[model samples]
Target: MTNDFSPLSQWQLDRARRTVHRGGVIAYPTEGVWGLGCDPWNPDAVEEILELKQRPAHKGLILVAASTDQIEFLLAPLDPEMRERATRHWPGPVTCLLPDPEDRVPFLVKGDHSAIAVRVSDHPVVKALCEAAGQPLVSTSCNPAGRPPARHGWQVRRYFGQGQVHIVPGALGGNRKPSRILDIVTGQWLR
Candidate 1:
């Protein structure tokens, strides 16, 4: 699907990218709401996300990529049919739980599970951020646990406050609900 969502200026995107690379968190627009993102490979950054959201480490997190190639490591272990089924929903709001072989994903991001939740976003700003960061980002709704996700830049600031999260100004991509999560192995709908 074409991303008709509002765009962020080059400087804003650059700063957000830098923040992620430096192990800092960023708040950016997603398909349904604002999301907090950090480098998935950076354990410190993931810890910050967990602390900010008041979320437990065992709950796991979602990773958002700009393209399927960014998550090839996680997809390499799936069978052909299962891989095809999962990749077909890419560049959209569908989050698929796929097998994580070799434990490539960090324990904090995968939690206690052998599967990791992932999505290739169609949101323009998110795609840009991921491209700039050169990998998929650890993404979670931009709010404390049990609270509503932020839908606007102002709300992100309100929730995280200044200096807490670098807000990447943009608009949501018109998805009314959070992405539908499915387990590729069992064909189960998780959300």
Candidate 2:
């Protein structure tokens, strides 16, 4: 399948933001592959992503933000050392599991976990989308459970079908692997 959603333009970004604001899901380029995203605060939107990917709710989802400020609530509780360790790899392909005090993240996004997985994206499209959305977004690989993540827009459409998700056209970053997951408290690599 061929994709019309390439070389992301400002108009496409606006459309994607509108779709997200209306509680719709979208597919956009990430550091390594296409990712499905939605407003993290919207349960319906999050559920749509899970349904489209056939992902179990217990697995949770990763949240991507444009800047650390967008997720300060989740990061504020960490001590200085843990906070530094958690944020040392920001704006890159690294996801950190941090303690969620006050539980600002919804249970669906956090799943059954006490910590939330988050990343401050360095990819321009992802950063712009999060900035346009004005908050963190729920991000998961753009494919069903057990399937390889979509590497291109057409693959995203083939997996979820056109019109099911707003396709935000862009190129993946240079990373060849998904973001490495690290637990801030244990200094362990979860991925």
Candidate 3:
């Protein structure tokens, strides 16, 4: 698949955004694996992804963004030191669990926890998709629970099928493992 954000890439990004806006799930490349994304605010879409993965709602999900600005609403309540510590590892492979004081994030995305897992991605396709979507997306590995994450386009298709998800054409970032998960408040690693 294409790497750079060319015109065709932009077109695909636009289409992906449209699909997410319409409450559709999409599969795209992320730092280490293929990720399934949809509007985090849409309960139906989030439920669809959960059902597709055979994952329970209490496990929660990660929200991927193009930049910290896109998720400032979720980060604004944290202490400056905590915020800095969390964001410092961003634009890369690190997902930080930030506290949501006002309940801005829906329960379906945050699951049974009070904190929301989020990441600012450096992958071009992920960044482009988040930018086009105009918000953080519900990003989780594109594979059913108890299975390995998809590292190839074919694997993504095989896991989700052709019409089940809108596959955004791209290549995975050069990372062997998925993003490390950290809880900023306690400074503990979750993954």
TM-score each candidate.
0.95, 0.94, 0.95
Q: How close is candidate 3 to the true structure, as a TM-score?
A: 0.95
Q: What is the lDDT of residue 133 in candidate 3?
A: 91
- lDDT leader: 3
Please list the Cα RMSD from the true structure of every candidate, rounded to 1 decimal place.
1.3, 3.4, 2.1
List where candidate 2 sits over 4 angstroms from the true fold. Answer: 1-7
lDDT tens digits, residues 31-80, model 3?
Answer: 88899999999999999999999999998999999999999998888889
* Model 1 poorest 10 in a row by lDDT: 1-10
After superposition, which runs of candidate 3 have C-alpha atoms over 4 Å from their true positions?
1-8
Ranking by TM-score: 1, 3, 2
lDDT per residue for candidate 1 within 1-191, as digits (tens), equals 34566677788777888899889999888888889999988999999999999999998999999999999998888899899889988878999998987999999999989899999988888889999999999899999988899887888888888999888877788789879998999988889
How much is 186 displaced in model 3, in angstroms? 0.9
> Considering only N, C-alpha and C atoms within 3 Å, which residue pairs clash in candidate 1?
none
